[model samples]
Target chain A: MKLRIYALAYLLFLYAPIILLPLFAFNDATIIAFPLAGFTTEWFSELTQNKALHEAVKNSLFIALMTAIFSTLLGICAARAGAMANFPGKRGIIGFVMLPLVLPEIIVAVSLLVILRQVLGVNLSNWTIIAAHVLICTPFCIAILNGAFQNLDPSMEEAALDLGESRWSAFRLVTLPLVMPGIISSMLIAFTISLDEFIIAFFLTGTNPTMPVYIWGLLRFPASLPVVMALGTLLVALSIILLTLAEILRRRGIKRAGGTDKGGFL
Target chain B: MGLLSAPFTYAILLLAVPLLAIVLFSFWTQDFMDVNTTFTMDNYREIAEKPIYFSLLQRSLYVSICVTIVTVVLAFPVAYFVSFKVHPSRKSLWLFLITIPFWTSYLIRVFLWKVILGYNGVINSGLINLGIIEEPLTFILYNVNAVIITLAHAFAPFAILPIFVALEKIDRSLLEASQDLGESKLMTFLRVTLPLSMPGLVAAVLIVFIPTIGDYVTPELMGGAGGKLIANMIQVQFLQLNNAPLGAAIAIVAMLSVTAISLLFVFLNRRWLRGRS
Candidate 1:
C-alpha cells in the first residue's frame, strides 16, 4: 500500500545515518566510500588500543554521570517547588528556567565560555563542561520531572503528613517512590544530552575532548574515517539504548500513575 | 528552607550570573590588556555598517525558512499517516523511529552527509560511474545547498514530532462527520485537518526556525564561504577576532530578529486559529 511505503521512507529518513554508521565502521578500508574493501574487525579493534580515545571516553563518561545526577537532583527540587509550594513569581521563575531550551545554544555556549574564561578566570577542564551541561540539562530534567510531579496525588502527601511524618519524610516515602521512574528517565535523558552535545564541549574543553568533539577533530583527517565511524557506531548504539530505556521508564511511570500529559520529551 | 535554598542558590549563582554577565559583556569594549568598562555603541554600529552582515543574516533566515517549509510539507503527510492511518499500537513505534536520530551525536549525522556528498564520496562516485557528470561536483559538499540539506536532515524530526502531537489531539469523530457530510478526502484534510493542526505547525516552525538560524556547526562544516551565516560571524568576533562586544552585538541582533520572526508567525497563526474557532 502507499501508506506502507510512506511509513517505510519516513523511518528510513530518520534512521539511515544510524544504520550507515556501523556498516562502514565494519568495512575494512579506511576510505568511507561505497564498495566496501572487505569485511574486517580492525576498526573496532583499533578503538580498544587508542589510549587518547579511551581517556576521552572516560572523561566524557565521568562528566555525563555527574551532569545527570546533579541536574536530576536540581530538577527534583525545582519541580517539587513549582508543583507543591505556593511561591511568588512562580510562572516567571519557570519561564526563566526554561529559557535555555529556546535560547540559541551557540549563544549559551559563547556566553558560558566568556564567563568561565574571561570573567571568572577559571581553568577549563571536565568541570567546565559539566557546569555547561548542567545549565542546559537541568531545564530538560525539570520539564520532564514537572510532568511526574503534576501527575501525583497531593492527597497522598497530605495523608502521610497526618500520620506523623515530616514534609521531607512524606516526600521521600510517598511522593519519591511514585516519581522514581520519572526521575530515572530524567537522568537517562540528561546523560544522553550531555554525552552527545558538541558546541559547549568544543568551547569549554581545554585538553580533554568529549566524544563528539573528538569526532569533529577526526573529520579533518581523511584516514580517520573508519575510526570515526567505529566510534559513531558505538555512540549510536549507546544513545539508542539510553533513549529506549528512558521511554520505557516514562511509559511505566505513566501506566503506574494511570495518567497522561503533554511534554514528555523536550 | 536552607536545604531548598541550595539548588536555587546554585542555579542562580552558576546559571543566572553567567547569563547576565553575557549581556553586560556585550556593552564593554575590548582593550589590548583586557576588556574595558566603558559602554559604547561601536559594536552595534559596526554590525550595522557591514552589508555582508545583513546579507549573511538574510541568507541564514532564508535557509531556515526554506528548511521549515520543506519539513512542514514533508512532515504533514507522515504525521497524518502516523496519527490517523496507523493503528494506535503502531503509533509509538513510528514516534520512536522518528526520534531515535536525536539520541545520536549531531556531529556524526553531519559527518555522514560529508561522506554522502563528498567529491569522491558515495553519491558523487555513483554519479561519476554512471557518467552523469564528467567531473565530481564540489557544490554538493561545501555550499549553501549542503548546509540546507544537512540542517533539514537534522531538524526534520523536530518538525515532525510537534505536528504529530497536534494531529493526535484531534477528535476522530470530526473527520467521520466530514465524511458523513460527503466531503472528499483532500477537501476534508484542507477544511478540517489542516486548520486543527495550525498550533503544531507554528510550533514546528519555532522548533526548526529558531535553532537553524543560530546554528554555527552546519554552516561551518557544510557551508564554505557560500554558507557562512551570522552565527559564524558572531563566532569569529568572539573567538578568533577577540571582539566580544561586536560578537555580542551581532548575537543580540540575531536573537532579536529570530524573536521577531517567531512572534510574527505566532501572531498570524493565532489570528488564523481564532478565525477558525
Candidate 2:
C-alpha cells in the first residue's frame, strides 16, 4: 500500500508540469500566474496568425522530414547489415555510430559549427542542421530497426533467391516488406527527435530557425510567454501522438516477426 | 558488400571527423580570420591557469552528482513498483505512460518548471490564495536547488527505464528461493533483487550524470546568475568570447573528466559485484 502511494506520487511529480502546460495555455491570462482567468482559445488562434512562427514551423517540418528520411535510410542499411553480416570490428563500428546517443549535443553542435564555419568554409544552413540531426537520429533509428531485422528469418530471403528471384528483387520483396513496420517506426522516432532537437539546430542554423530555436527566442519576451505555452501544448500533443504511434509500430513489428518483446525505446 | 558498409562509412565521417576536428582545434590557436594550424598548449594552459574554469568544472560535477543521486533514488521505487507490484498486463501501459513526458519538448519542460517555481508562478500564487504564506519564497527559483529539481525531473524517465529493464530481467526463481529459505520479503529483495540490478543502476547513473553535467539549457532557463554550469561557460567561450580554441579546450577537458569518472564508476561497480559474489 505504501509503495503504491509512492508510485502514484512519483507519477504525479512526473506529470504535473505537463498537465500545467495545457491548463495555463487555455487560461485567458497573459501573465502565467494563478487565479484561473476563464478559458480562452485566443492563444491557439494567435499561433496561426504569427508569420514568423509559421515560417519557423515550416523550417522545422522540412528539416524533420528530411532528417527522418535520411536517418531511416541509413538505419535500414546499418540494421540489415548488423543482422546479416559478420565483420571484423562490427561491434566497434556500431558502438562508434551510437556514441552520439550519449555525447553532449552542445559538444556536437560546437564541433560541427567550428568545422563548417572555420575549416570547411561552408555556410551555415538548413542542410547543415539536417546533417547534424541525421547524425544523432540515425542511432535511434538503427536501434529500432535492429530489432526488426534480427527477428527476420534469413531463410526467407534465401528461399526467395532460390526460387529464381534476383538478390535485389528478393530483398525488395521479402526483406523490405517484412521490415516495413520497423521502417515506419524508425522514421517516426527520427522525425520526433529531429523536430524537438534544439541545441544543434540553434548552433548550426543560419538565418531561418527551427521551432525550438524560435521558441527559445520568444522566451525572452515576457508577453510572448502565453503564446509559447500554447505552442508547447500543441507540440506536447503532437509528440505524444507521434511517439505512441512509433512505439505501437515497433511492438507490432516484433509481434509480426514472431520475436519476444525485449525492451524498446519506450 | 560495399552497400552494406555505406552507412558505417558515413557514420565514421560524420561523427568521427567532427570529433577529430574538435581535438585538433583544441591544440591550435585562433587568430582573427586565420586559424594557426601550428599546435600549441596555450589552450590547456589557459584552462589550467584559470581558477574560474576549475571552480565551474567542480560545481558542474557537484550538481551532476546531486542530480544523479536524486534521480536514481526517486526512480527506484517507481521501477520497483512497476516491476514487482504491477500486474503483468498493465506493466507496459504504465511504462508507456511514464515515457509520454519524455517525448514532450525538453526546452518547454524546463521552461514549465520556471513558471511553476518562479516568484509569482503557480506554487507561490496557489499558496498565497490558500493563505499558507504571506510572502513568496524567493529561494526556490534561482538557486542550485532549482537546477537540481528541474534536472532530476527531466532525467527521471531515463533513470526509470534502465532500472526497470534491469528489474524486469532479474530471475524470478531467485526471489522464490530466498522466500523458500525463510527470508523476509525486504531481505530477499535486498539480497537477490538490489544487487542484481546494479548494472542498470550504474547505467542510469552514468546516463543522468554525463548529460546533466554538460546541460546548458536547464541552467540557462531555470538557473539564474548563480546557477550557471560549465556548459554555460563553454557556450560563452564559443559564441560570445569568439574563442573557439578555448571552448574546444574546455569541452575536451570536460569530456575527458566525464570519461575518467565513468571508467572509475564501472571499475568500482565491477569490484563491488565481485566482492559480493
Candidate 3:
C-alpha cells in the first residue's frame, strides 16, 4: 500500500514539469507564476503565424525525414547481417557501432565539428546535422530492428532461397514483409529522435537552425515565455503521439513475426 | 558480412574517424585560424594550471554523483512497485506513462524546471500566496541544487527502466520461499531481492552518471553563475575562446574521467557480487 502511494507520487514528480507546459501555454499571463490567470489561446495562434518558426520546422522535418530513411536503411543491413551471419568479431563490431548510444552528445558534437568543419573545411549545413543524426539514430534503429529479425523464423528465408530464388529475392520476398512493420516503427522512432535532437544540430547546423535550436533562442527573451510554453506543449503532444504509434507498430511487428508479446520498445 | 559493408563504412567514417581526430587534435595547438600540426601537451598543462577548469570538473563529478544517487535511489522503489506490486496486464501501460515525459523535448523539459523553480516561478509564488513564506524562495533555482533537481528529474526514466527490468527478472518464488522459512519481508528483500537486482542498479548508475557529466543544457539553463559545469567550460573553449585544441583536451579529460570512474564502479560491483555469493 505504501509502495502504491510512492509510485503515484513518483509519477507526479516526473510529470509536474510537463504538465506546466500546457498550463502556462494557455494561461493568460506573460509570467509563468501560478495565480490562476485566465485561459487564452493567443500563444498557440502566435506560433502559427511565426514565419521563422515555420522555416525551422520545415528544415527540421526535412532533416528528420532524411535521418529516418538513411538510419533505418543502415540499421536494416546491420540487423540483417547480425541475425543471419556469423562473421568474425561480430560482437566487437556491433559494440563499436553502437558506441554513440552512450557517448556524450556534446563530445560527439565537438569531435564532429573538429573533423568536419576544421579538418575537412566543409561548410556547416543541414547535411552535417543529418549525418550526425544518422550516426546516433542508427544505433537505436538497429536495436529495434534486431528485435524484429530475432523474432522471425530463419528457416523461412532459407526455404525461399532453396526454391530457386536469389538471396536478394528471398530476402525481399520473405524477410522484408515480416519486418515491414518494424521498419516503419524504427523509422518513426528515428524521425522523432532526429526531430527533437538539439545538441548536434546546434553545433553542426550552418545558417538555418532546427526547431529545437529556434526554441532555445526563444528562451532567451522573457517576453516569449508563453509562446515557448505553447511550443513545448505542441512538441510534447507530437512526441507522445509519435512514440505511441511507434511502440504499437513495434508490438504489431512482433506479433506478425510470430513472436510472443514481450513488451517491446516503448 | 557483405551486407554489413555500407553501414559499417558509414559508421567508421563518421563515428570512429571523429573520435580518433579528437585524440589527435588534443595534442596540437591552435593559433587564431592556424592549427599547428606539431604535437604538444600545452593544452593539458593549461587545464592542469587553471583553477577554473579544475574546479568545474570537480563540480561536474560532484553534481553527477549526486544526480545519479538521487535518481537511482528514488527510482528503485517506484520500479519495485511496478514490477512486484502492479498487475501484470497494466505493466506496459505504466511503463509507457513513465516513458512519455522522457521522449518529449529534453531542452524544453530543462527549461520548464527553470520556470518552476525560479524566484517568481510557480513554487515561490504559490508558496507566497498561501502564506507559507513571507518572501519567495530564492535558493531553489540558479544553483547546484537546482541543477541536481532538474537533472535528477530529466534522467529519472533512464534509471527506472533498468532497475525495473532487473526486478522483473527476479523469481517471485524465491521471495515466497524466504518468507515460508520465517524470514521477515524486509529481510527477504535485503537477502534475496537486493543482491539479485545489483546488475540493474549498476546499469542504472552508469546510465545516469555517464550522461549527467556530459550535460551542458541543464547547467547552462538553470545553473546560474556559480553552478556551471565542465561541459560549459568545454563549450567556452570551443565557441567563445576559439581554442579548439584546448577544447579537445578538456573533452578528452572529461571523457577519460567518466570512463575511469565507471570502470571503477563496475570493478567494485564485481567484487561485491563475488564476495556476497
Candidate 4:
C-alpha cells in the first residue's frame, strides 16, 4: 500500500502538467482555470492563422529535417569509427564526442554565441542553429548507431568481400542495408532533439524564430496561454509519435542484426 | 566513399572548429578591436572576487543536491514497481507512461508549474475552496521551493530510468536466497536488493545532479528572485552584462566545481565499494 502510493505520487508528479496541456488547449476560455469553461478547438485553429507562428513552425521543421540528415550521416561515420575502427586516440575521440553530453547547455550556447559572433565576425542566423544542433545531435546519433553497428557481425562484410565483392560494394550492399533501421531511428531522434532545443536556438536564430523560441516569446502574453498550450500539445503528440516509431525501427534492426532482446539507449 | 568523406570532413570543420576556438579564447584575453596575445589569469580571479558568484554557485550546487535526493527518494518506488511488481508484458506500458512527460516541450511543462503554483492557480484554489486558508499562498510560486519542485519533476524520469535498469539487472534468486535464509522482507530488500541497486542510484544521482546544477530555465521562471542560480549569473554576464570573459570565467569555475564534486563522489563510492567488498 505504501509502495503503491509512492509510485502513484511519483508518476502523477511526472505527468500531470503534460496531460493538462492538451486539456487546456481544448478549453474555450482564454484563462486557464478549474471547471475549464467548456471545450473548444479555437486555439488549435488559431495556430494555423498566425503568420509568425506558422513561419516559426516552418523554420523549426526545416532546421530539424536538415539537422537530422547531417547528424545521421555523421553518425554513420562516427559510429563506424567508434564501433569497428581500431585507430589511435579512439578513447580520446570517444570522450571528445561525449563532452557535450555533460557540459552545460548554457555554456555551450554562450561559447557558440561568442565565437560565432565575435571571433568569426559571422552573422547569427538559422544556419547557426543548424550548426549548433548538428554538434549536439551527432553524439546522440553516434550513441544510437553504435548500438546498431555493434549488433552487426562484421564477418558478413568479410564474407561478402571474399565472395567476389569489393569493400565499398560489400559495405553498401551488406552493412548499409543491415543497419538502415537504426539509421532511420537516429534520424528521427536527431530531428526531435533539434526541434525541442531552445537555448541554442534562442541565441543563434536570427529574425526567424524556431518553434520553442517563438513559444518563449509568446509566453510573455498571458492571453496566449491556450494557443501556446495547443502548440505544445501538437509538439508533444508529434515527438511521441516520432520516438515510438524510432523505438520500433531500432528493435527491428536489433532483431535483424541477431542481437539479444534488449540493449539500446532510451 | 565520397559521400562518407564529405560528411566526416563537415563534422570536423563545423563542430570541432568552433569548440576548439572557445577553448582557445578561454585561454587568451581580449581588448579593444583586437584580442591580446597575452594570456592571463585575470578572468579566473574576478570569479573569486565577486561575492555573488560564489553564493549563486553554492545555491546551484545545493539545489542540484536537493533535487537529486528528492528524485531518488521519489523514483525508487516507481522503478521498483515497474522492475519487480509488474508483469513482463506490462513493463513496456509502464515505461512508456514514464516517458510521456518527456514527449512534450520541457518549457511547457515548467511553465505549467508556474500556473499550478501561482497565487490563484490549482493548489491555492483547491486550498481556498476547502477553506483551509482565507487567502491564496504567495510563497509557493516564486522561490527556491518552486525551482526545486519544477526541477524535481523534470528529472524524475531520469532518476527512474536508470534505477529501473539497475533493478531489472538484479537476480531474483538472490532475493529468494535471502528470504530462504530466514530474513524478513525488509531485511532481504535492504541486504540483497539495496546493495545491488547502488549502480543505478549512482547513475540516477549523476543524471539528476549534473543537469540540475547547469539548468537555467526553471530557476529563471520559478526562482523569481530567491531562486537565482549560477546559470542566471552566467547569463547576465554573457548577455545583459556583456562580459564574455567574466562569463567564461564563471562558466569555467562552475564546470570545475561540478567536476571536483563529481570526482569526490566517485572516489567516495569507490571507497564504499571497497569496504563492502
Candidate 5:
C-alpha cells in the first residue's frame, strides 16, 4: 500500500518537467514563471510562421522516414534469424549488433562523423544522418520484433517448408503475415526515435538542420523560449499519439494471433 | 547465409568500422587543417597530464553513478507495483503510461529541465508563490545536480523495463512458501524477491550508467560553465580544440572505463549471489 504512494510520487517526479512544457507553452507571456497571465496560442502561431522551422521539420520527416524503413527492414532479417536459427556465434553477433542501443550517442555521432567525413570523404547530408539513425534504430527494431517473432508458432512456417515451399517463401507467406503488426510498430517507434534524436543530427546534419538542431539553435536567444515550448508541446503530442498507436497495433496483433498479450516496447 | 547478409554488412560498415577508425585515429596526432597519420602517444600523455580531463572524467563517472543509482532505486518500486500489484490485464496500459513520457523528445526534456530548475523557473516560482520558500533555489540548475536529475528522469523507463521483467519472472509460489515457513513479508522480500531481481537491477544500472556518462548534451545544455562532463571535453577536443586524436583518446578511455566497471558489477553480483546461498 505504501508502495502505491511511492509509485505515484515517482511518476510525478518523472512527469513534472514534461507537465511544465505545456504550461509555459500556453501561458500568455514571454516570461515563463508563476501566476498565469492569460491563455493564448500566440507562440504556436509563431511556430507556423517560422520559415526555418518549417524547413527543419521537412528535413526531420524525410530523415525519419528513411531511417524507419531501412532499420525495420534490417530488423526483420536480424530478428527472424535470431528467433529461427541456432548458429554458432549467434549470441555474440546479436550482442555486437545491439551495442549501439547502449553506446553513447555522442560517441556514435562523433565516430560516424569522423568516418564519413575523414575516412570516406563523404559529404554530410540527410543520408549521413539517416545512416547514423539506422545504426541506432536497428537495435530497437530488433528488440521489438524479437518479441514478436518469439511469440509466433514456428511450426506454421515449418509446415509451409514441408509442403515444398522454399525457406524464403515459407517465411514470406506465413511468418511475414504473422509479424506484420510488429513490423508496423517497429517502423513507427524507429521513426519517433530518429525524429526526436538530436546529438547525431547535430554532428551529421549538413546545411539543412533537423528540427531538434533548429531548436538547439533557438536556445541561444532568450526571446524564442516560448516558441520552443510551443514547438515542444506539439512534438510531445505527436510522439504520444505515435506511441499510443503503436502500442494498440501491437496489442491487437497479439490478440489476432490468439496469444496471450505480453508487454511491448511501449 | 541469407539472413546474415544485409544486416551484418550494414552493422559492420556502419558500426564496426567507425569504432575502429576512432581507435586508429587516436594513435595519431592532429596538425592544423590536417590529420597526421604518424602513430604517437601525445594525446594520451596530454590526457594523463591535464587535470581538467581527470576531473571531468571523475565527475562524469560520479554523475553517471548517481543517476544510475537514483533511477534504478526509484524505478524499482514502480516496476514492482506494475508487475506485482496491477492486474495482468492492465499491465500493458500501465507500461504504456510509464513509457509515454520517454517517447517524447529527449532534447526537449533536457531543455525543459533547465526551465524547471532555472532561477525564476517552475519550482522556484511555484515555491515562492506557495510560500514554501522565500528565496529561489540557485543550486539546482546549471550544475551537476541538474544533470543528474535530467538524466535520471530520461532513463527511468529504460531502468524499469528490465527490473519489471525480472520481477515478473520470479515464481510466486516461492514467496508463498517462504511466508508459509514462518517468514515475515519483509524477510521473504529480502531473501527471495530481492535476490532474484539482481540480474534486472544490474542491467538497469548499466543501461542508465553507460549512456549517461557518454551524454554531453545534458551537461552541455543544463550543466552551465561548471557542469561539463568528460563527454563535453571530448566534444571540445574534437570541435573546439581541433584535436580529434585527443577526443578519440578520451572517448576510448571513457569506453574502457565503462566496460571495466560493467564487468566489475557483474562480477560483484555473482559473488553476492554466491555469498547469499
Candidate 6:
C-alpha cells in the first residue's frame, strides 16, 4: 500500500511541472505566482505575433526534418551492415559509433565548436547543428533499426536473390519494405530528439537560432517569462504526441517482425 | 566491401577527429592572432596551480554523486512497484507515462524548477498562503540543494528505466524458492532481488552520474554564485574568457576523472557483491 502511494507520488512529481506549464500559460497572469487569475488565450495568441519566435520555430523544424532524414539514412546503412556483415572489428566499430550516445553533449558541443571555428575554419550554421544532431541521433536510429533488421529472415532475402533479383534490387524490394515501419519510427524519434536538443544547437548556432536557443535567449528578459511558458506548454504537448506516436510505431514494427518486446528506451 | 565499411569510416572521421582536436588544443597555446601549434604543458600546469578549478571540480563530483544516490534510491521503489505490483498489461503504459517528461525540453524542465523553488516561487508562495511560515524559505533555491533536486528530477526517468528493466529481468522462480525456504519478504528481497538487479543499478548510476557531473545548464540556471560547477568554469574559459587551452584541459581532466571514478565504483560494487555471497 505504501509502495503504491509512493509510485503515485513519483508520477505526480514527474508530471506536475509539465502540467503547471499549461496551467500558468492559460492563467492570464504575467507574474508566475499563484491565485486564480482567470483563464485567457492571450499568451497563445501572442505567440503568433513574435516574428523572431516564428523564425526560430521555422529554423528548428527545418533542422529537425533534415536531421531525421540524414540520420535515418545513415542509420539504415549502419544497421543493415551490422545485421548482415561479419567484418573484422565489427563489434568495436559499432561500439565506437555508439559512443556519442553516452558522451557528454557539452563536451561534444565544445569539441565541435573548436574544430569548426579554429581548425576546420567552417562557419557555424544549420548544417553544423545537423551534423552534430546526426552524430547523436544515429545511435538511437541504429538501435531501433537493428531490431528491425535482426528480426528479418536471411532466407527471405536469399530467396529474392535466387529468384533472379540483383543484390541491390533484393534489398530494395524485400528488405526495405519490411523495415519501412521501423524507418518511419526512426525518423520520428530522430526528429523529436533534434527538435528538443539545446546544448549542441546553442553552441553551433550562427546568425539564426533554433527554438530552444531562442528560448534560452528569452530567459534573460524577465518580462518574457509568461510568453516562454506559453511556448513551453505548446512544445510539451507536441513532444508528448510525437513521442507517443514514435513509441507506438516502434512497438508495431517489433510486432510485425515477430520479435519479443524487450522494452524500448521510452 | 568498401561501401559496406563506409559508415564506420564516417564515424571515425566525424567523432574521432574532433576529440583529437580538443586533446591537441589542450597542449597548444593560443595568442591574439591564432592558436599556436607549438605544444606545451602550461594548460595542465595552470589547472594544477589554480585552486578554483580544482575546488569546483570537487564540488561537481560531490553534487553529481548526491544526485546519483538520491535519484537511484528514489527510483528503486517506483521501479519495484511497476515491476512487481503493476499488472503486466499496464507496465508499458506506466513506462510510457514515465518517459513523457523525458521527451519535453530539458531546458524547460530545468527552468520550471527555478519557478518552483525560487524565492517567491511556487513552494514559498504556497507555504505563505498556508500560513506554514512567515517568511519564504530562501535556502531551497540558488544553492547546491536546488541543483540536486532539479537534476534528480530531470534524471528520474533515466534512473527508473534501467532499474525497471533490471527488475523485470529477474527470474521469478528464484524469488519463490527463497520465500519457500522460510525467508522473510525483506530477506528474500535483499538476497535475491537486490543482487540480481545490480547490473541495471550500475547502469543507472553511470547514466546519471557521468552526465550530471558535466551538466552546465542546470548549474548555470539554478545554481547561483555559490553553486557554480566545473562545467560552468569550462564554459567561461571557452566562451567568455577566450581561454580554449584551459577549457580543453579542464574538459579532458573532467572526463578522465569521471572515467576513473566510475571504474572504481564498479570495482567496489563487485567486491561488495562478492563479499555478500
- Give the number of the best model, judged by DockQ: 5
For all candidates, the clash counts are 0, 0, 0, 0, 0, 0
Error of 1 at B158 (Å): 1.5
Ranking by TM-score: 5, 3, 2, 6, 1, 4
**Ten contiguous residues minimizing lDDT sum, candidate 1 chain B:** B1-10
Q: Is the docking of candidate 5 incorrect, acceptable, medium or high quality?
A: medium
Per-residue lDDT of model 3, residues A1-266, tens digit only: 99899999999999999988899999999987767589899999999999999999999999999999999999999888898759798888888888787788899899999999889999998999999999999988998898788879989988998899998899899999999989999999999999999877888888998999999899899899899999889988999889999888887888899986545352
Q: Mind giving the per-residue lDDT tens digits that candidate 6 earns over A1-266? A: 99999999999999878977987889888887676498998988999999999999999999999999988988888888888768787788888888777788878888889999898899989999998998889888998888787888899989999999999999999988888888998998899999999978988998999999999998888788888889999998888888888878877777777676666653
Residue B212 of model 1, lDDT score? 80
DockQ of each: 0.53, 0.64, 0.69, 0.46, 0.72, 0.61
The prediction achieving the highest lDDT against the true structure is 3
Off by over 4 Å in 2: B1-4, B128-132
Tell me the tens digit of each residue's lDDT in model 5 across A89-122.
8888888888898898888988998899889999
On the 0 to 100 scale, the lDDT of residue B22 in model 5 is: 95
lDDT (C-alpha) at residue A205 in model 5 = 90
The DockQ score of candidate 2 comes to 0.64
Tens digit of lDDT per residue, candidate 2, span B151-178?
A: 9998898899899999999999999999
> How far does residue B232 in candidate 4 sit from its true spot (Å)?
1.5
Question: What is the DockQ score of candidate 6, to 2 decimals?
Answer: 0.61
Instruction: Give the runs in model 4 whose Cα sits over 4 Å from its true position.
Output: A1-5, A85-89, B1-38, B131-134
- DockQ score, prediction 3: 0.69
Model 3 residue pairs with clashes: none
TM-score of 2: 0.96
Name the 10 consecutive residues with the lowest summed lDDT in model 3 chain A.
A257-266
RMSD of 6: 1.8
Name the regions of candidate 5 deviating beyond 4 angstroms.
A162-166
lDDT of 5: 0.88
